[model samples]
Each structure stands twice: as C-alpha cells, then as structure tokens.
Target chain A: MNYPNKKKSFQKEVNKANLGMTLESDIDATNRYYLDSGIAVIHKKPTPIQVVNVSYPARNKAKITEAYYKTPSTTDYNGVFKGKYIDFDAKETNSTTSFPLKNIHPHQISHLTSVEKQNGIAFFIIHFKPYNEYYILPIHLLMPLWENQYKEKGRKSIPYAYFKDNLHQIHFSYQPRLDYLKVIQTVFNF
Target chain B: MNYPNKKKSFQKEVNKANLGMTLESDIDATNRYYLDSGIAVIHKKPTPIQVVNVSYPARNKAKITEAYYKTPSTTDYNGVFKGKYIDFDAKETNSTTSFPLKNIHPHQISHLTSVEKQNGIAFFIIHFKPYNEYYILPIHLLMPLWENQYKEKGRKSIPYAYFKDNLHQIHFSYQPRLDYLKVIQTVFNF
Candidate 1:
C-alpha cells in the first residue's frame, strides 16, 4: 500500500502500476499463473552469472564473496505454447519516440536467427513506458531493420510511427496483464 | 594433461567424476562447440538460485553475502534441433544395476509430460558413468515405469538391463563428444 517515496505526481502514478507491479513482474505473474493452471509452460531463465568465489558458512549455507553477471548466451524467456516452441526477449524503453537498436544486442539477433531456422517462434515484446504501449514485434518484422543498421549505418532505431503502422499491438488487463500470449494466438494462429 | 591426482585405476577413474565435472561439463563443452560451428543451438540452463543479500564492493564488483540453491522449474538443457523443439535432463547414477528414481523429482516428470503434450521432444540422457554408457531414453519409455512405481510400489530404479534393451544408445567422438544429436537422428529419424 506504500511505496518508499511519498511524493505525489505523475511519477507516483507510474509507480503504482494499478496492482503495484511493473510490466516485467506482471508478465512473470502471468507466467506463474499459466504454469500453475496447466495453460502453458513458460519461464524467464535465470540470468547466467559467473561466481568467482564462495564460502560455506554452514552445511547448507553458502556465501558468495564474489560474483559478476555475465553476458547471457541466449534470450531471456522461452518455453512451449500450443505445441510450438516460443522464444522471446522483453524490452522497456523510456524514449517514447523510438525504440533504440542498441537495446537489442548482436548476440541476441543471431540467437533469434538460429531459433527461427529451427521453426521456433521468435519475437520481441517492446514496451514503450511513457505511452503505456506494448507490441509483439516478430523477428521477421525486425530482421530487415536489424540488417540495415549495419548495411546503411544510417538509422539505429525504429521510429514509434513505424511501430504504430506495423506492430501487433497488445492490450493490458487486470489479471495476466500483458496478455502477449493472446497476441501470439493472433500472430501464429496456434 | 593434469588432473588433481595422477593415480590410475578403475576406482580412480570413477573418483575423477565425483568432482562434479564429468557429464555436465562435457555437455557444456559440447554445446559451446555446437554454437561456435553453427551446428545446432542448445544450452544448459543455469541452475536457478535465490539470493538473500548482496553488497557492492565497487561499481564493477558485487559481493553476494548470502544465497541458496533454488529448486529449478524446468530441465537443465533445452533448445532447437533441426526445426524441432527439444528439452531434456541429464542424470548420472553411481549405481551399477539401475538408475535411482530419487535422482528425478516429481516436478521434472510433470514438466516432461507438459512438454510432450506440447509436441516438444522430451527425453533423458541417462549416463551410467561406472559403465561409461549413455542412453537417450525418451519419456514414453519411462512413464509406464514411473506410474508403476506408484501403483505397485515396485522398485524405484529402472534396471540397467532395461535401458540396454530399449534405450537409444549413442557413441562418443572427439568433438561434440557425446554425439547425442546423432542418437536423436537415429531415434527420431530426423
């Protein structure tokens, strides 16, 4: 019921998020609900990290004295849906005008490419926070822009206008808020 | 050229694996080679862990003072192979006669069943290390026995003889040493 800061403004309104959860956490909750109910099996894989040192304080207690987050070798989320393999990454951009290409790394692009070849569903869930908008932009729609970034080296981001015209926009709700899987149904028909 | 101990004997050969680097590390190496060569995309998911406390020693360094291993929600390895979604866990048993049922948990079996319903390739790579044997035994083969464990209160382990008779045996090679994909090719005919 209370956030640390008592300051009231649009910032405070943004902090509430209705049920007091971020878009990412909401997706996580939705996933938990899905898995619990036998609807689907999806999970955000643990971020791969390197542990340099650790000490055992007790038989079961572990104290990691040193550790570092490593560059992930694959996408953040993956699982099966409707008898189809689904893989995706979720991104949030503060910029309301465009989604920065830098947010999508080269390794991730290649990972999606590999998944595509394997007939797995590959896409990005881009959330524009300012407008409270989310879009399920498939790899097919993104690959050309990704390739052109290197070929022409002119534009390094996708304009909001482009997304407005071509994206598979997803609506939010009270429970299972993101409902990107609903968009998956529309996109993949699975 | 050097292992911690230089001792050579059948018993010592078995002791080398107790360091926790035999099957898992080899598979990790195999996956790395596969990714580098653009052969097939597969990865061993990092074990999920719970962090209780953390402190930053510097801008670039983190000190996790407390943490604990968490129950994983899914299998250790999963990825796409030849346009097919694949998922499996690798289990090693010291027992010579049978693989211990306790090596597997109830959640993993349920996870595999869900994957099967979704048309994903689900199986177990059971490595009988003492005998240096590996079998790509699918869920369909293990389920009846698993169910029987509850119904008849029979042996909790699947005998080595049963695996040898029905398992999809694979050979080791210099590169991608286990060559489990080759076994998959034979078993799935892909």
Candidate 2:
C-alpha cells in the first residue's frame, strides 16, 4: 500500500498525543476492525485541498509541491451504519474544564442540522485531553451550546462535567479505541 | 475563504483546455450554489497534508513554505442528498474516445464497491474533454471495467462510445454546472 507521507506524519502526531491513542489513529484502527469484522462501513473523510504547484517527475506521475487547505463543507467521517446514514466529526481538546465551541464551524453545525432533519445520525466523539475520556454528543445538544457561546461573551466552551452528565461516554478498548458505535446503539436505539 | 495554492497550476492547465470550464471550478460553483439555495448538503472532501516547512510572516498565522499532497483513502465528495447518503468522485479526461481507468485507484474502486453493497449511491461523473459531454457511470459498471483493465494487458481506458451507450448523461447548466442530481433522480429513483 502506498501510504502518503502526510498520513505518516499524522500518525506520528497521534502517537505524540498518547491519550491511550490519538482520536484519528483510534478511528483508523476502529474502522479497519469494523470493516474486517463486517460490523459497519465507516471511514474518515479526506480533507479538501487546493493544489497550486506540482512537479511532474514522470510523464503520468505528478508530485504536488504547493497546496493550501480548503475549509470542508461537511463532516469528517460518514457512512452507512445499520441501515442508517451516519455523519460525524471526531475532535480532541486538552481543556480540563470545558470543550471549546471553536473546534466546530457554522457550516458544520448547519450540515449536522440538515442531517438531523433528514433523520440521519449526526453527532461528535469529543476526547478530553489528559483524562482521555471520550463523549458522543449529539448535534441537538451541541447546537444550543454553539449558539449560546456566541450570544454570551467569554462563554465558548462546554464544561467537561456537563458532558459527563448529559452525553454518553464511550469506553475505549484495545480493539476499538473510541468504540463509539456501542454508545450509538444505545443513543439511537439501533 | 482561504483557498489552497496547490491546485492553482492544475486549475490553470485545466482552464487552458478551453472546453468550457474546469471540473474543479464547476464543482466549487455547484457546491456554493447548493449552499446558497439550501438544496442537498454536500462538499468535496479535503486531502490531509503534513507541512514540512513554514515561514511565520505574521504573529498569529504561519505560512506554509513546503508541503506535499496526501493520497486520500476515501472518495472525493460525499454528503446527505435528499435524505440518502451520497458518495462519489468527479474525473475529467482530455481523450475524446476513452476515459483512462488509471485515473482511479484500486482502493477507491474497493471503497465504492463496499458503498454500493451497503445500498448507498456510489458513482463517478466522467467528463469527456473537447466534446464537453458528461456521464454518471454506476459503481457496478465501473468495477467490471476496472477489473478488465487489470486483466487485459493492463488496458487503462474505457471508450467514450461505451459511456455514451451505457451510462446516464448529465446536462450542464449555468446554475449548476454539473447538475448531477437530476441524473441521480433518473438513475436511482431517488
């Protein structure tokens, strides 16, 4: 397999986080496990990039040299899970008290809202740094916090305690580092 | 909006063809239109990159000096379309007679196959250069061609006549340049 150099760096960065494991690497391992075991078909969506310069070393092969990241218009991970379309973003924050609302964008919130309107499962797996605790917070709950963050000054985060109380906590295991589907089963009643 | 610089030259080369417009530009315009009109929620996925060199010209944001394009593990564009999960890739060819199979990777073909198995709509929009004709070829049709390409002397192309006869043709309009949803409705009964 021709793994991209960026993926290797991403993996290295994940290793540095060392919160049991990074959110991205965990997602990758979990997806591989699920695909192998025939549990669900889920994958991390690639980041959109605009390539400006490339060096053609060979006739058909071109190596991109200059590119800039484009703001994605949708969620990071999405696929069919148990007959329902699943869409979500996985984020990690080091804040001990609260998770910042800045991690998400207005377009993402809008996208999740539409997903909910369409009856698809839309949520996020938020990892609290240092503690290594992961919570699956539904879009319904996140929208209010996101809006309130802007409405109220100096309030742009969700308390870790709030997540512990309201959201379903996903227990990380060796097999599936995030193991969010277990929480999904209970939350969506699927 | 921070547009990526990496695709500048590529887009320029595409525009130089002078057929009508570029696939990338058309996609961007279509997505913007969709967002503005409140149609289906969709976006092109990003390519994750690792910034190897950076020059901090400003205090807040650092400019990337050197970077490499990452090979995406999944498809390019995906989102909720009329309550169904839609996943696909858009590819263009300068060849008037055939579309090269080499443009697609084995992993992508495998991913699309799995998407189809899960009952999600998976397909590709083939843009025929010079003629400016576009066709949406289902994953089922593409898999065979992909396999045949590998087996038969590594034949790396599918003729335009084959696409004309087998695939659903998509008409481009000013509003939605590659307005594929119309073809999607006719093809998938969605």
Among the numbered candidates, top lDDT falls to 1
lDDT of candidate model 1 versus the reference: 0.80
Best by DockQ: 1
Runs off by more than 4 Å, candidate 2: A1-21, A46-73, A94-97, A150-156, B1-21, B152-156
Write candidate 2's Cα lDDT for A1-190 as tens digits.
9745765665665675585346788888998887777677798776566667767654444566666557787877888766568899888887899888888888789888988876788998898977878899999988778878767484788988899888888888889766788889899887
For all predicted structures, in order, the TM-scores are: 0.85, 0.79
Residue A171 deviation, candidate 2, in Å?
Answer: 1.0
lDDT of 2 by residue, B1-190 (tens): 9654655756776666554347867977887787567677677776666667654454434356576656677788776666677788888888888998877887788777777777788898888877888899889888777878668486679988898887888888989887887789899886
Error of 1 at A111 (Å): 1.1
Candidate 1 RMSD to the correct structure: 7.1
DockQ, per model, reads: 0.46, 0.32
Whole-model Cα lDDT per candidate? 0.80, 0.78
Kindly report which residue stretches of model 1 are placed more than 4 angstroms away from their true locations once superposed. A1-21, A151-153, B1-19, B151-153
Write model 1 residue lDDT over B31-143, tens digit each, in one string.
88877777778888986767676665554355666666678878999887776778999888888999988888888899999888877788999889788888998888889
